[model samples]
Target: MTADSGILVLAGTPIGDVADAPPRLAVELASADVVAAEDTRRLRRLTQALGVQTSGRVVSYFEGNEAARTPELADALEAGSRVLLVTDAGMPSVSDPGYRLVAAAVERGVRVTAVPGPSAVLTALAVSGLPVDRFCFEGFLPRKAGERRSRLADVAAERRTLVYFEAPHRLDDTLAAMAEVFGAGRRAAVCRELTKTYEEVRRGGLGELAEWAAEGVRGEITVVVEGAPEQTVVLDAGEMVRRVRVREEAGERRKEAIAAVAAEAGLPKREVFDAVVAAKNAERSGA
Candidate 1:
């Protein structure tokens, strides 16, 4: 058997509490040949907490410098360096800047691994009291209102629970947009502060949450929305097609429209697709 090449270790740090840092993380930090941190200052603080001295070289790697730094890191890994990548919080390259480096390393056949520890996505989903068996991480929505709403239109039918991260100031607008796109009665939970003091989880319908958010919310926020309800065979198929067509006309592609319709109508994709196709063909044949 062949030995593995140098590895890219993606280390996940704590979101709020430093004590939450995994014990193995410190060992990796002390032993790694190259420590790539989002913020060197924070890395120093973490090292201080861990009381681990790094004998290897330490370098800054983040959003601004990621593109330029990737090749350098990849070279070190190629030279048999155990490259350890850490972000400000949570996992690296997860809505963070480590993707470039990871991609470059993977392309060169460098082994990639992780010191899995804290994750806001799973933490929020776990504590949100929503179904966690199946879910999707949406990260963050677009900042603009129109773009955000249009994006939400795609997941309106997602049956497996949905999760998202949102900014404090934009919480109200985001909740309102979700209410409009996902429906007023859709159940959701907003988790804030995570594992820190003042950690909060607000659970309610999209409409109520929107109203509450209008008063303002603070701290890091993660929102989990219940998937669209399953369709009852008795529901109107024609109505579902009409609604899906509306979304399609609003810049959503046919697949997205069909998905939305299927979710809303609580029907299978084939059923919705057949109805949509038949409706289009009927207009073409003038039947």
Candidate 2:
């Protein structure tokens, strides 16, 4: 690990419109000692559009080469070289290759910073018309349908807005899977090619979005879905205990049964489990 190295800047690039590029982006591109770009050609075009000339050493740093290049980039940072990392679009390492290098640089005591710019996560969430006060960004789900559904099912009861990025080819399937797991009535917004000329954001229920994508979608996709609403129930402690015991007797694990009973009773798992244990003790005394 190198010491007292220069700063590692994780700069965000525009996802679509060139004019969306922040003023500081060009300056950083021009001044950094080394530019690790996901696509050097894209960086070249970006700098060209911004009318900035980069004299820095520009090298490819993408998924394929990120592992190999992280060490080199860290070394450059340790050597007091200003290494600016840029991805094709959005913040580097959000769902991109810069995380490895960023982690490496930080571990080596390199100063790490970012030029916060465009983000598909924030952009989609903002325009999705969903509850943005609290949200979670889930980069990309597994490509397989079964795995995707299982992943989404894990968050089916989440109360925070959910955000995800998907490629066009898999957009339809992903939306369908979301509909199945999160419910067809779940509200969501599909943002396509954000900030570009033909950019489109379709806001509707999961079922509608799935149908729309079935007609074929294009460009980068960002999907934001509204969170589940809170449930209300007034079941007594004895009933809660009996429910968990019933499920547990039916081959479900005690932990899972407890969670199921909690969800059914509209109470926290801990609260429900405590009640269940108390009920069990009372029943044992009676027996």
Q: Using Cα atoms with residue i matched to residue i, what is each candidate's TM-score against the true structure?
A: 0.87, 0.83
Q: Mark the 10 consecutive residues where model 2 has the least summed lDDT.
A: 259-268
Give the per-residue lDDT of model 2 (tens digit) for 169-271. Answer: 8999999988876778889999998999898999999999999899998898999998876775677887888888888899866776776566555466778
Superposition-based RMSD of candidate 1 using all C-alpha atoms, in angstroms: 3.1
- Going through the candidates in the order shown, the clash numbers are 1, 0
Candidate 1 TM-score, C-alpha based: 0.87
lDDT of 1 by residue, 1-287 (tens): 11556889999999988899998899999899999999999999989988898878999998889999999999888878899999989999988889998889878988899999899999988888889999998989999877787688767777889999899999999999899878889999999999898999999999999999999898999899998777554546577678778988899778767866776666776788888888889989999
lDDT of 1: 0.87
Q: Give stretches of model 1 more than 4 Å off.
A: 1-4, 233-238, 241-262, 267-281
Stretches off by above 4 angstroms in model 2 are 1-4, 233-287
Candidate 2, residue 4: Cα displacement in angstroms equals: 5.0
Give the number of the best model, judged by TM-score: 1
